[model samples]
Target: MVRKNIIISSLFLGLVSASPLHLKRQDLPIDSYDESVAAGADSTDTPPVGDAVPQNVETFDSNTVAAEVVATVVDTPPAVAQASNDTPPDVIAVNLLKRSDMNVARADGPATSCIVRTFNGPQVSDPDTPGAFTSYPAFSTAAIDSVKAANVPSGYAAVPNFVNLNAVAQDKSYITYTSSKLTSYDPKKCAAICDATAGCTSFNIYYERVPLEISKATQVPDAALGCPGNADAASATLIKCAFYGMPLVATSAKSVYQYQGKAFKVVYAGSTAFTKSSGPTVDGLQGPVTFGDAAINAPAPVIDHGYLRTQTFGTNVPFAPELCAASCKAQTEYNAKHGTNKGQACIFFNAFVIYKNGKDGVFTCNYYGTPYGVSYAKNRGQWDDSGNHWTISNSFGYYVPGNYVAK
Candidate 1:
């Protein structure tokens, strides 16, 4: 057996929402790894103000779903940070290295850097009845492998990836009201489970921790507990998957339940896809998207070191900050060739993974769909405007066409 020792670091990114219950920056703890990657510099680290230009970029899979926006907190590392480094179940660890490697293959993979498998859900017209629990399908490596083809609608994209959430207390109204639980919960199959059930819309996948009691009947040895002579110890956690079609409204009775139990962590919260009459659109297609310089003011929602969106672009395309913008420019033409309704054209562009090589700090192009949201300059400032001076990095200057009409 090839023992794959997966090391999941506890690296979490913060999220800010446009909702009333906003996520503060402090709530989002920073990680050293992310900072190192963001801090890398290249030749165009800082471009002169007004020198940066927009470039064409490609589109990514997108849907204009309602923004419950739990902020799929991208976990930089896996949740199970065990000291013993025991090999986890193969199904759980295989997709842990979720992002597609630009260095190797570009075949179908997870939508985000986080790896969570999407499955072909049973197309039930309605969720199963209330008070009735359903079992998630058994784990199958073959079933997972079949869906690994690119550009196909595998209902998997509907699943959201959340990191480091606490387990839910069973007494919580939402959990109590949910009433459906599945043993051997797999986050990868969350989408299918929710869809198969009647009235089901959202679900939470989490690990449930239980305490070990060393009574006469249940003799847990010290070696097993990792605490010799300790009467009380916690047993290894069990993962539980809960499904709910109802919205977790912020009422007086419900809001408190969010923080109540040891089982309160949330691995993923999935909802129906974002709906839009038309697909994602570039808000402003400004031209001459420049490369490398210092900035007067940069836009919001910057992609400093996001995982490369696709393997083809990352491997075949040379490191060019303007590659995404160039892809965006040719989008209209691409759309003409491949039906605008198809939404195959690139909607957003980014240049990431900056590194220094001699005089120039080089970076590569990445494409994306409509982001959950975007930020422009405040107070009518077009610092993010085209031909404006927006800082890319300290060493080199690059700009992502910030304006987008996301779904």
Candidate 2:
């Protein structure tokens, strides 16, 4: 059968949080994979940084619940190094290479980069779960026939192509999947399993790893223990984003026990809350705060890469970034149509302010809403009217708090 190998490189980006005990950083949305591609593990790598702060007395859960301003930890990766050709599962990040071209007649052919395949290796598949051997869905061959329509990156390396880097997994949490018999199943089912299980914020979908030729007798062992005698042996893993949860269809948890015997739990909703005054303790980071909102004016050119906000100029129409983005997006689309910057427009979110808490520990977002249209720095002096610099711009910047993981 024709198959595609799906891999991802661990492009480790760090996160600093406004709070940790509550596990902040929800606004961050790194690219996952293309809409349809599956993700894989790192074969080569580096690692960590600062400890996570305490999470009040509760937990952070992903359910539709609101948590408090808990402490957060930042991840700092070591410099990059060449990956070993036959690296171990966790040794390096996952990478997807283009295999042989496929038959054009087979509509949902290999061309659809979204169709994913995982690395052949040992895995702890939950035999009872429907997705024990899950695979990326064959969305549509349209993507395949559409590369002729893809917008190549400005300076992409000779590599084929990649879409959503945000979808890929940034954290590695332990897991235990239930099992079932149907080898083929819906991914949503697995998501449900995790969701219903109190603290399962996420889930993993496993398909047979490559080198499937190995005997079926040891297929389980092979996956669980990884290929025979490889020192780098470890199960290949990826994250599942599905909103709903599911039940595993192929394998069941070997033990009703916890992963590595560690207790399984999720961060409870609304556990912690932070105010303008107190932010989380980030390593090497000071309390200096910056509150940002989108400013809306007519569409303007994007000058740099940072948080963006906009304010309207004609009268007092208040602020809205989504509307600005829509306008900006439209302008970019226009550029594309007019052969101008073709699809290049700078749109900031609604105008918000960053509360620059200075070198001190004081911080707040608008810290005060209503009234005199939010505080403004006439100049960078004392809430004053002198040597100003932080000019509360006509447009506000997007609020991008650093990533925060609890210690």
Candidate 3:
């Protein structure tokens, strides 16, 4: 009877241990087993009596040392195997390198002094001062032709900024400005030409519409089909690029154009180089020009159209952004009485220009009739990484009208 009782107890213990294998079966890595079995290892189809059998298991008894060895061989968690195998090689290398001992450097230099100075265009011949305003050189017919001839098979001459053939005729007659037409049309190519030429600040390109049959055969999108006034691609009569010496003054004429047979309706007309000394002059303001508080969400001051202008009084005082602001305010008051554009009240003070020397760096305080606050400096002036020099740019400011007029 005691022997029978011992057998029964052993069976009961085995059954209790076997129940855990069934419970943990879901966590087994099936791929490992299939691969091991295919690789010709001996293992049972059924699980062991006391524990789950690992893939290609060599022995069944826990007392056997080989069984422990087999367990150790397949000890890797399934998730660990998957994660290690699926990761990209580069990602793995990055992680491994990150684990190694390495240090990163940071800037700890002293803050740069905000000194103010003035500069004029290097090529400007008038006033004999570096910062004084001068007339921009006009483009010659030969220069324009040189740009057109350089166009290759795969590039454009000028790109659309905001172009309209009708507007050009109505507001700014090409007759007033120096203009030359290209025998062929390419927006990027024209722009590249302007970029290459110094006097060629801005260029405009016009395209004639494509024929209806060609448009339908090309399967062009509706937007590219044409515009409202000039609705058909074929209706386009001309495709020409015109370079301007000054900012195209904004007129009461509407700013609209249509796709003749191209993707864009407006080719950019802004200049790559300085168009004029400052912006075009208009009436400043009527009555007392009170400098108001620096505006909130101030519109950035732009040149005549979208160009740059400034008066670089030869570098005298230490450069500071505030100095430029003060100078502009003073200039506005001066203009009110004796200035050429007397009514002009606002001015744009830009201190960020090319830094030349320690005491006499490039800076300017330009006067304008209107004070449009800067939205954001397109190129936040800073150190030029390529040139290894400190660069400054217009940060922000607004028109102060009727404020305590700087004496």
Please give, for residues 1-407, the per-residue lDDT of candidate 3 as tens digits. Answer: 00110000000001113333222211111112222222222211111111111111111111222222223213323333223222100000000000111122222332231111111112223432211211222212222333443532122222222323233322111111111234444445555654454323334443322222222222222333332223222221234444442223222123333342343232211122111222211133221221221111223222122211233321111122343344445445544544323235544432332232111123233334444344323332233335433333222332454432222
Residues 1-407, candidate 2: write the lDDT tens digits. 33333222333222222332123312211122111122312111000100001100111132111111100001112121112221101111122222232322322333212212233223433441212323223211212222232422111111122111111111112222332312332234443454444423333332222221111232222323333313222323222222101111111111111111011111100000001111122223222222322222211121112122121211101122232323333333443444322223332222332112221001011110111111322222123244322222222332213311111
TM-score of 3: 0.20
Q: How many residue pairs clash in each candidate?
A: 59, 118, 52
lDDT of predicted model 3: 0.26
CA lDDT scores, all candidates in order = 0.24, 0.22, 0.26
For candidate 2, the 10 contiguous residues with the lowest summed lDDT are 44-53
Model 1: runs farther than 4 Å from truth?
1-161, 167-185, 213-231, 247-407
Task: Please give, for residues 1-407, the per-residue lDDT of candidate 1 as tens digits.
Answer: 11222212222222222411111111111112123223222102111111011211111111110010111111112222111221111101000111221131232533222211112222111222110112112222322332344521343332212222222211111111111233343444554654554323334443322222221212222234333323222232333344432221111111111111122211111111210111112235422232222221222222221211221111111232333444434443434453331334345443332222111112223333332222311111123223432222211122235643332
How many backbone overlaps does candidate 3 show? Answer: 52
The TM-score of candidate 1 is: 0.21
- Best candidate according to lDDT: 3
